[model samples]
Target: MPNKHPYTTLISAANLLPNAQLENWVIIDCRHDLSAPEAGRAAYDAGHIPGARFAHLDHDLSGTKQAAAGGFKGRHPLPEQDALIATLRHLGINDDTQVVAYDAHGGMYAARLWWLLRSIGHASIAVLDGGLAAWEALGQTLSTEAPTSAEGNICAKPTLVASVDADDVLKNLTNPQRTLVDARAPDRFRGENETIDPVGGHIPGAKNRFFKDNLQADGRFKPGHQLHEEFSNIISASQTAVMQCGSGVTACHNLLALEIAGLHGAALYPGSWSEWCADAGRPVATGA
Candidate 1:
């Protein structure tokens, strides 16, 4: 069983200011540019929240990709369990540590880290509400000085956190009780302007939510009640919802939004479109 922690889903920069100096708290800068790849570290080096550590999506979070045998495991496969345990401990996260992750692109990348922690059964994590922009807006200081702390003794207690594999997704297509929500943009979901994946279009019966819908104009998440209202129409509190995106990254934003909305039990399809499309026999759907 995964360990449980009493942590809120979102934490404001203002609320985090006082706790920033605590020894048991960890702030991770999850900023990343999917295109540039190295841009996240460069930006972190320039300036990041005080006492924040950098987490690279591809290097720190994902596992190695062996796309040799035509059985590639998607672009960003989950990191090996032991490797993830080492990375978390290196980041100074222990059982009681309060983790706050932030990113420039809304909470897209940061939510991935948040989801990973929760999947490991460590719920003492939250996404910095409104992200780094929210912190900057409050005039919080950014530190070029890398904060160092002794390595932590946190251990991984992995749990199967409501995720479905490609085969399960295929089986769910005919199951009316389940709903597949794609977090990609409308264009990408419709297979109109796809440039990343070799094949375009979404799963046969998937609906597009475009993760950004959960955010306001300022890039912060919408209020809880508002979020609940927006999602209630698509997924009920009791329904089983599966989230997915180009390569299992942005889909986490949807999962975060669902949690914020108090609509729980949504699972992640980590293999997502990247792995689903890898098999030529899988069905694809396009257009409005």
Candidate 2:
């Protein structure tokens, strides 16, 4: 059978080194800036972990943006399954491949890939703990050359994660069964920072969690017990959790943190705020 110890959530730089050369392992560099979209590819061209291929956040990970009923789909919508499968295949990922994704900014971008993989039911994926900084700090060498592999034969399987759309989120405002956790910075959540999306504030009842809280000063994730304790304070026993951010990107970071915290079954609000605020009719709430 496939590798016995496939990392499904987070893997450290040290543990990754020994298995870096394995044929079954595929590393992807998912470094991207939301403002300067091209910056990620440029950084990849400079140097990346050996055998790591680049997956652009916009082109590879997300779906096309088009008009929806009330307004537009979010900036980064989920990709069509066939398109995602094709991208994975082109990147040499097989069904059994142990995929590891990393980026410079903690695991924000990398976590997107990790969640996408799980959405396709490929559970053998993980984020590089502390990301590229951790790898470099370990005195590991980087490679400028690219690697090639035969196309992957992977296909979509049943989704391992859950996702809610704008309609579901709208309904939640009234029914409020699921707990909506906003992963944006407090300023943004408060509608004070409108630099990213056109509208500020958040969905009516979203609890501000700020994705960065999951990280330590060194950029690594906090210990599992600590994460569990912190998340427990926000999410109680009765509510199902739903994670969201600007365009469903950094929200994955929170989802990863939840998984690390031993809290499972949290769903993603894929369109998130960008989609939620697109329509003027949708209710918005500002302030803490």
Candidate 3:
């Protein structure tokens, strides 16, 4: 059985002032461009939130090689456990630090870190409510100086991590206690779009609940009750759930939505369909 992680909710920009930051709070800047891998880091070096360390989606957060699955598909994959621990150490995270992550667009990238931290059994972490965009809108200060990583007693409790393998997914085909959600756009899920992946389809048993459906026109998460209703419409609450997307990035968006909906207790398919498709033997479903 995988250990359940403890996560904190509702962290705002004001909660991350310099005084609070020094009290052992870790901040990570997660930014990236699908087509422009170097842009995110270059932007970080130019300027970033004071004391903020960069977490690149392509390099730091994900694996170097993308499998043949339709998801990551040669784009990005989750890093190995040892590599993940080392990266976190490089960012200077300790057991007591209140880790906050943000990105330029929204919490799309930041949520990946949030889910990863929880997977490792540490959840004293939260995604910036509105991310860097919202933080700047609130008149928070910025800086060009990068922060140094602190050496601390942050250890990875491997037992606490929860993961779903290819076999696990196959077994869950008829398991009433499991639900798989695809977090791509409706067009992508329906195979009407093939711009990113070589094959345009989804896992056979997966349902379509585009991640954008979880948000309102304001670019913020919908009310808890509404989100609950949305999830219930596709999958049961009493069952365990897993989310996936193109290469596992946008899947973080759906996981974040589930969190915001207070539907807690779900896992992510870090490899997503990309990994699944890479095998060619795995089943796929395309078209509406």
Candidate 4:
């Protein structure tokens, strides 16, 4: 069911191989380590999928943080809409283009691109299931040769996906209609892991989904039926859910997984834990 559309939320490496050489298709390599900012571009330079362009998490995907605001928007905020549209146009993506994004660390980073495109009303995007590892595991070849694409005339339309701000989250805490789903790991959700953000713990009412649970042992997303069953157990089919992570990156992974599970209408909390923790007055929850 997930593969029913060419522009579905998830696509397999095998399905991507044949059309990879096509002109209208754009493949992006979204590999990055939060600790080592330059590593993703370095890895892309070493070798990448043929014709794939590199999109760094910090440079291309995120916006600037104001020190004056004390990082109120979080470490990796969403790029300004105009700037992001320019970047996409520079990448030679059009309204009809088929975009495939991938990363070595599962679909964590790639899902962000998928969600961003979808949010901006561009529906022709998919995360490379299993990511870079899957491409290599299938005995496919990699290329260091980069292709130059003509500038595309893509424009950002109205946003289709829903997003929640800090205020909305605070209100949801008391509103029985919404559920907050945290994509961070169990330890981080419990205030035990404090590596990324200075403050630990999660939004008071959020439940931990760990992002990785969306994948199988091989790192590919679980089958749609299984995904639907898993998410349904945590969040009711009737309740609206908001997805979030440490700094809003991995939250997209859970969002993508939810779409694959056929559970649509879940919104993104882009500020996430980083933004939530920035203000001391906001409530925080510790332990499972």
Q: Which is the leading candidate under TM-score?
A: 2
Candidates 2 and 3, the one with greater TM-score: 2
- Tens digit of lDDT per residue, candidate 1, span 33-109? 98899999999999999999999999998887664455677999888778898999999989778889999998999
Residue 191 Cα positional deviation in candidate 1, in Å, after optimal superposition: 0.2
The lDDT of model 2 is: 0.92
| Residues 1-288, model 4: lDDT tens digits | 122356668888999999898888899999999999999999999999989988989988988875445657888888888888888988888877889999999899999999888878888899999998899988998999877999977788777688888899988778756888999999999999689998999899788899999999999999989989999988885238889998889999988888888888888889899999999999998999
lDDT (tens digit, per residue) of candidate 2 on 1-288:
577878999999999999998998999999999989999999998999999999999999998888434456798999888999999999999999999999999999999999999999999999999999999998998999989899998889999999988889888888988999999999999999589899999999889999999999999999989999999989884139999999999999999999998899999998999988989999999999
Please provide, for model 3 over 61-95, each residue's C-alpha lDDT reduced to its tens digit, 9 standing for 90 to 100. 88767444534433567787778888888888877
Ranking by lDDT: 2, 4, 1, 3
- The TM-score ranking, best first, is 2, 4, 1, 3
lDDT of each: 0.87, 0.92, 0.74, 0.87
Best by lDDT: 2
Which ranges of candidate 3 are over 4 A from the true structure?
1-7, 18-20, 66-74, 158-161, 174-177
lDDT for residue 160 in candidate 3, whole number 0-100: 31
For model 4, the superposed segments whose C-alpha errors exceed 4 Å read: 1-5, 67-71
